[model samples]
Target chain A: MFNRAILIGLAVLLACVVAPAQFRRGGGNAPKEGADAPDFNLKVLKTKKKKIKLSSYEGKKPVALIFGSYT
Target chain B: MQFLLVYIREAHPSDERRGRGRGRGRGPEVKQPKTFEERTEVASECVENLKLSMPAVIDNMKNTAGTAYAGFPDRLFLVDKKGKIAYAGARGPRGFSPEKLEDSIKAVLKNKGVAPRKSTKNKKSQGRGN
Candidate 1:
C-alpha cells in the first residue's frame, strides 16, 4: 500500500512539471505572428555601454533576437 | 542592422565545468556558472572562440529573456522595422536552422525595401560582436 501511494505521488509530480512544457511547445507564449514583440532592457557584458532596450531600436532597423547560452 | 543574443541558462549545464571530450578532441573544462558573472565569463569565452559578429544580451535573473523566450537551448526571432514579429523560428538542434533565419531576414528586408546583403561571417560562428 505504501509503494502504491508513493508511485501515485511521483506520477503527480512528474505530470505537474512536464505538462506546462509540453503545452508550451514552439511559439508558446511568444508574441503571435504579427504582434509587436515585447521590448526588454538587458545588460551587455564587459562594456561601459548602457542597458539595451528593445524600444531603443524602433524605427532605426529590424532586430534579430537570438536566445541561447554557451555550453 | 541589429541582432540581439540573449544568453540564458546553460544547455549542457552539467557538462560545463570540465572539458568532457577525449584525445585531440579535448576542450577546456569549466563548471556550470552558478551566477550571472560566471555565466557571462563562459559566454565571453564562447564569443571570443567563435568570432561571432552579433551583439548579445545577458539575462541575469534567468527569468526575463530566458524563460520568456523559451531560451533554454536556443531560439531565434526577427522583429521587423515596424517592431512587429516578422518570423519565429523553431527551437534548437533539430529545429535549429540558420537558413531559415537568413531567409526570413532577407524576406523582411526585401519587404521593407532594403537590399539583400550576404553575411560575411561564417554561418556556424557564434559571438557577440561589438
Candidate 2:
C-alpha cells in the first residue's frame, strides 16, 4: 500500500508540472515588439456584413488594436 | 491614428468564473458564445451599452488574432504606419490603461511631426499628410 501511495503521489506531481507547461503552450506565441504585426481579417461587429483586414491599413496609418471582450 | 477594438473570447463567463460575480449591479451574465453569430451579438451588446465610438471587430471562432497577440482577457497594441508593433501592452485586466495607450498614440503622432487632434471628430482624419 505504501508503494502504491508513492506512485500516486509521483503521478500527481508529474501532472501538476506538465499541466502548466501545456497551458502555456496552448496560449501560442505572441508577436514581439518591433516585429511586423500579424495580419488578420475580421468581421466588423457593428456591421456584421463588413470585414476589415489589418493589411489594408499597413502603409496608411498607425493602428491601435484593442483586444478584449465584453466580459 | 486608427483604433480598432478586436473582440475576443470571454474573460469571465457565467459558467467558468461564476464565483467572482460581475461586480456591477446586475451586470451582463453571459456564457462564452459558441457560434460566431452569438459572439457578434454579444459584442454588439457591449458596443451599445458602452457607447463605444471606435469601430469594433470580432475575432474569428478560432481566435487567430487573440492567439497571435496574446489578447485573451484584454490587452492593447499600437502598430506603426510600417505595420510593426510599436507598443504591446501587458496582459490585462491590470494592464488595460487607456491613458497609457493614449500617451503612446500621442508620442507616435509627435514623432511623425503631426499634432494630436483636439476634436474627437478629427481622430479619423489622422495620418493623412504622411
Candidate 3:
C-alpha cells in the first residue's frame, strides 16, 4: 500500500509539471505556416499611441512578430 | 526587417504558477491586469525594463491578437514580404531559442536576396511574458 501511494504521488507530480507545459503549447487555432498572417490593428505602446496594422507592412518588408509579455 | 513585440496576458502571475522572481525564492509578484489600461501599464514596464528596441503593441483586453496567434507565454512568427508566414517558431519558454530564430531570419533574408546589415553589437535578447 505504501509503494502504491508513492507511485500515485509521483504520477501526480509528473502530471503537475507536464500538464501546464502541454496546455501552454496546445493552444489551438494558432495561424499555420504559409498562411497569410492574421491582421491586427493593435495599439502601439509608445508616446504616439498610434495604432499599427499588420497589413500595412505587406509587400513593404519582412515583419517579425514576437508575441510575449512582461511577467 | 521590422520587429514587433505583441504583449499578451500574464503567463505566471503571483496568484497562479508563481514562477521564480528576480531573486531567490521570491516569485515575480504580479496580478493579472483587469483593464486595458492596466495591461498597457504592465507592458510598458516590461519594455522599459527589457530596453526593448522594437516597437511594442498591446493586445486588446479581449486578447484578440493573442487568441489569433495563440501567443500566450511566448512565440515567434516571421512574416515574409508578401505577408505570409515564412517561419513559425515553436511555442516558447522551452521552445524559445534566439539562435534558432536568428537562423530562420537569415534563411528568409537569403531567400529574398536581401543582404543582412552588419551590426556593431552582438547582443542576444529574449522576450519574457507574464
Candidate 4:
C-alpha cells in the first residue's frame, strides 16, 4: 500500500522532473553544443551560382547558421 | 561573426495549402522547388520579405545540410571558431528564441579566444564571395 504509493510518487517525479532535464542535456537525432558541426558545401543563393562550405569558416569567424524555409 | 541562412525544403509547402487569401488564406501557392534555380527563387523571396541582410544558402536536393543539422522547419545555431556548435537552439516555430540566441551570441563574442575577422576574404569561398 504505502510502498506502492512511494513507487507511484517516484515514477511521477521522474516523468515530471528528471526526464525534461535529461532530454535538454542529451542530444537526440541532432547535433548539440560541443558536437562537431557536420561539414557541408551547399549552394549560395545568388545571381551566379556559388558554393558555401561550412568547414571553410573553421578557425575563423563563428558562423551563425540559420536553417529554415519560406513556407 | 558571420551569418548564413540555409534554406531547406518548404515546411508547409504551398501544395499543402488551406484557407483563402493572405490573412485569411494560409500562404502563397508555391510548389516544392524541382531545381536549384527554383529553390533560389523562393529563398530570395524569403530574404527580401524579411529584409534580411545576411547571406543565404540553399540546401541540396537531398537536403544534406538540413538533415545533418536537423534543421527542417527552422532553427538557429552558432558554431565557434573551432567549428564546434556553441549554441544549438531547439526545434523552431517553438524553440526559436531571439533572446536566448542573442545571449549565446553575446557569450561567444565575449570570449576573446575566438577573435573577430578583419577585411579578409574566406580563402575557400572564391566564387562564393559575399
Candidate 5:
C-alpha cells in the first residue's frame, strides 16, 4: 500500500511540472514552421499610428513580432 | 537585429493605485492594460524611457500577435522576408537570449540574400532588450 501511494504521489508531482512546462504563458499555440503567418491590426506606439495591419507586411517583408512588458 | 516589442497588459498595479483600491500588487505596479490605447501608451513609455530603438507593434485584445509569435513577458522571433518564421527563441525572463536572437537574424538575412547591415558602433547594446 505504501509503495502504491508513493507511486501515485510521484505521478501527480510529475504531471504538475510537465503540464506548466508544456503550456507556457508565452507562446501559447505557437505556429508551426512553414505555416502562413496570421495577420492582425496592432497599434504602433512609436508613431502613434493606427490601422497598421500585419497582413500588409505579407508579400513585402518578413515580420517578427516581439511580445513583453517593460516592468 | 530587426525586432519588435509588443507591450501588453501589466503584470502588476502601481503601488499608489493599489493603496487606493485602483489595482493589484505593490512596488511600482503596472496594471494590465484593458484597451489597445492603454497598451500603446505603455509601449511608448518603455521606448522613450529605455531608449528602445527596435521597431515594435502593439497586441490587440486577443493578443493575436503575442499568441502567434509565442511572445510574453519577453520573446524573440526571426522571420524570413517571405513572412515565414525562421527561428524561435526561448521563453523570456530566464530563457531569453539576445545573442541567439542576433544569430537567428543574421542567419535569416543571409539566407534571404540581404547583406548584413554593418554597424560601426557597438551592435551589442542595440540588440540587448531589457
Candidate 6:
C-alpha cells in the first residue's frame, strides 16, 4: 500500500475527478429513444381548469416536448 | 412539427424552499412553490417573460412529471407520431443545448413520411470508400 501522504493525494484527485457528477444531479433514469413516452395530463396555463394530454398528440403529429422553468 | 412546454420544478430557487440552491437564478428570483397554484402562477410568469408562444402545461404539486422523466431544472425531447420517444436531450443547466435539439427536430420531421422515391442517380461515380 502507498504511504499516508500518497493515499491522501489519490483521494483528493479522485474526488476532483468525480465532483462534476454531483453538480449534474438529474438526467439519470430519463427515458431512452424508441421508448413509450410517459403519459401526462397537466393543467394548461391560463385555462379554465383545462388539461393538455400527451397521449392526445400521438398518431396525429410529432410533438416536441420542451421541459423547463422560469428561473 | 408541434412544440409544447411543460413547466416543471424551479431549478435555482434563491430561497431554497424545495430543490437545490443555485445561488441566484438567471432570470428573476423565484422561490420553490409550496402549492400547485403558486407553481402555476410562476410558470405563467415565466412563459410571459420568455415570450414562449407555444402552449404550456404545469406540473402537479408532487412534481410527478418531472420525477417521471428525471427532467429537473430543464430538458428537451421529441415524441414521434407513434408516441415513442424519438430523441432525448442531455441534462440541463449546461447540457441543455438548443442547437442539438433543433437538429433532432429536423431529423424527426424528415423521417415523418415514408414515401418511397425513385433513385435517379447512382453514387458509384462519387463513392470515396466503402
Best by lDDT: 2
- Greater lDDT among 2 and 4 belongs to 2
DockQ of each model against the real complex? 0.37, 0.37, 0.43, 0.36, 0.45, 0.43
lDDT of 2 by residue, A1-71 (tens): 99999999989987898656544433335565567889999998766559999988877889999998887
* Per-residue alpha-carbon lDDT of candidate 3 for residues A1-71, written as tens digits (9 for 90 to 100): 99999999999987897667556664355676567889999999975859999989887888888888766
The stretch of ten residues in a row with the least summed lDDT in candidate 6 chain B is B121-130
For model 5, residues B51-81, the per-residue Cα lDDT tens digits are: 8887667777887777666666567665666
User: For residues A1-71, what per-residue lDDT tens digits would candidate 4 score against the true structure?
Assistant: 99999999999999988777644532344575667989999878763758889999887788888888877
Tell me the alpha-carbon RMSD of every candidate.
9.1, 9.9, 8.6, 10.0, 8.0, 8.1
DockQ score for model 6, please? 0.43
Cα lDDT, model 2, residue B4: 96
Which docking category, incorrect, acceptable, medium or high, applies to candidate 3? acceptable
Candidate 4 ranges with C-alpha deviation above 4 Å: A1-27, A47-49, B17-26, B113-130
| CAPRI tier of model 6 | acceptable
Cα DockQ of the candidate 5 complex = 0.45
What DockQ number belongs to candidate 3?
0.43
Best by TM-score: 6
Backbone clash pairs for candidate 2 read none
lDDT of 3 by residue, B1-130 (tens): 8999999998777655544443224434677898999998899888988899899989999999988887877888888888887666667776666776687688778878232433435212222121
- What tens-digit string does per-residue lDDT give for candidate 1 at B1-130? 6888877776655454323433113434556688877877888987788677677778875568766666556778788777777766566645666787788788877777232332557322321110
lDDT string for model 2 (B101-125, tens) is 7887887778772323245554334
TM-score of chain B of each: 0.71, 0.78, 0.76, 0.76, 0.67, 0.78
Cα lDDT of model 6 by residue, B1-130, tens digit: 7898999988777677543444364468788889998998899899888888999999998888887777777888878888887767667766677886687677777877111122435223212110
In model 2, the Cα lDDT at residue A61 comes to 85
Worst 10 residues of 4 chain B by lDDT: B121-130
Q: Write the per-residue lDDT of candidate 5 for residues A1-71, one digit (tens) a residue.
A: 99999999989987898556666644346554445656667777657465577666655565565667656
Model 5, runs deviating above 4 Å: A1-17, A24-28, A46-49, B12-28, B113-130
In Å, residue B33's CA in model 4 sits off its true spot by: 1.4
TM-score of 3: 0.74
